[model samples]
Target: MELTLVDLSVARGGVPVLAGVSLSLAPGQALVLRGPNGSGKTTLLRTIAGLQPALSGQVTGAEDRIAYAGHADGLKAMLSVRENLTFWAAVFGMRDVEQAMQAFALLPLADRLAGTLSAGQKRRLGLARLLVTGRPIWVLDEPTVSLDADAVALFAGAVRAHLAAGGMALIATHIDLGLDAAVLDVTPYRVALNGVGFGSSDEAFL
Candidate 1:
């Protein structure tokens, strides 16, 4: 399967941020998004992941095929590390969390409450959720935040494994994970304030 974004335009906070963006990702490929702080990388990723709507164009082959990991870790602080993975695993119709735990080295802290773990540990646990997703497309935003070098390497290894298994990834991060991935800079796609652009009143949904 292929994830294709054709002539896509996206907005944030009721204002157009990006326009005329297009890209495609087939199995075993990874695409890294690069842009300045307000360039709409997050907006584009959200649109592709189906978390938000695109003002124009089309996103195909992504329905029920994406596992998104945004800036927020999406963890249940009250749940134990293992329990958290179990919850997410079950949500995606999976039952085993052992492989996910080992992929991120969470076995040692399996019983620890998610809220008690350090920022890096929490991030690791958050990322481990992708392994249990069983989805072929990974849409990640700054996934390495708070992770140490070792943890980043672990995450990179996991991504490599995923790609080797014919999965695709669309990531927005500044750090280099050393993957043979294509980089797409969104700066060129930034919509001019005075230019004709799509508009929306849904300012509350960023």
Candidate 2:
């Protein structure tokens, strides 16, 4: 199934940030979202991931097919590396997390508690959760936040493998992962203050 967004308008804190946004991603494809800070990249991704409501338009073919990894690591601090992956796998009705663990080089740290892991290690473990999800579309926001150069390459490799296996990715990151993917700049879709209503609260969650 192809993920399609048509004339989509997404809001942050009940205020419109982007409007007239549209895109489509078929299997084995990836799209990188680009814009300055506070340009609604996170808001758009959250809307597409079904984490929030869209102010207008449609996001079709993405009902239960998206695996989203936002700013947070989404890890259970009390669980060990192996246990964390196992937990996410179970949540998605999967069992084997060996591949996921191996992909991120977590074998050596498998017995380590998530809270005791270094920042980069924790991020890797979080990204590994995507593999066990068995979802077709990956919606990631700054996925390489705490990753080092080598860790970034590992992520790139994982993404490449996922694409080779016919999965799609929609990422919002300033760093280039060296993937031959299409880029979508959301600058044109920025809504003027007078064009849409503004909420008193900021989009702090982003």
Candidate 3:
């Protein structure tokens, strides 16, 4: 499946964040969003995932076929890892919950409460929901946050495998994802007051 974001703009408390952003992602393609903090990368991902309202753009995709893993690691803290996975699986209508847990390497921590798991562990469990959902489009915000080296590699490999298998991904990350995906520097896409491009902080051309 393909997704497109056209003429996108976002604001927080009446302050402009992202403006005139447009992007297209197709199957077997991944795009990394790179920018410093407060650069609107996360906001763009959230808007595309339909989590936050888009102020003045269109997100066109198969709404039912999209999966999002945000920065916060959205998991039920009160439930065990297994329970959290099971709950998300049910929400996404997965056929086999055990397989999904095992895929994320959560079998050992399955019995432990999500609240008690380490930061890395929680991120893995949150990402594991995508395995269960089998969505075509993945919108991830800082997917590798708090992950150890091994977990980071695991997440990168999973994303690579997903793209290889004809899935689309929009990743907002500061670190390299180790995938042969294209880069969409949102920094340049930001408009400037005059035609001089003061808001474009992307250094690629410098």
Residue 92's lDDT within candidate 1 is 94
Write model 1 residue lDDT over 102-203, tens digit each, in one string: 999999999999999999999999999999999999999989999999999999999999999999999999999999999999999988867544434332
For each candidate in turn, give its C-alpha RMSD to the true structure in angstroms: 3.4, 2.2, 4.8
Residues 1-206 of candidate 3: C-alpha lDDT, one tens digit per residue: 57988899975444557788988899999999888666777667777877678779787884887898875688888999888877877887776777667666889997999999988888899888888787989888878878888888888877878888899888888888778989988887653434333234432211
Worst 10 residues of 3 by lDDT: 197-206
List candidate 3 stretches off by more than 4 Å.
Answer: 191-206
Q: Estimate every model's Cα lDDT from 0 to 1.
A: 0.92, 0.92, 0.79
What is the TM-score of each predicted model, taking all chains together? Answer: 0.94, 0.95, 0.87
List of clashing residue pairs for candidate 1: none
The candidate that wins on TM-score is 2
Q: Candidate 2, residues 5-52: lDDT per residue as tens digits?
A: 999999877788899999999999999998977788999999999999
Superposed by TM-score, candidate 2 places the C-alpha of residue 101 at a distance from the truth, in angstroms, of 1.0
lDDT of 3 at 47: 73
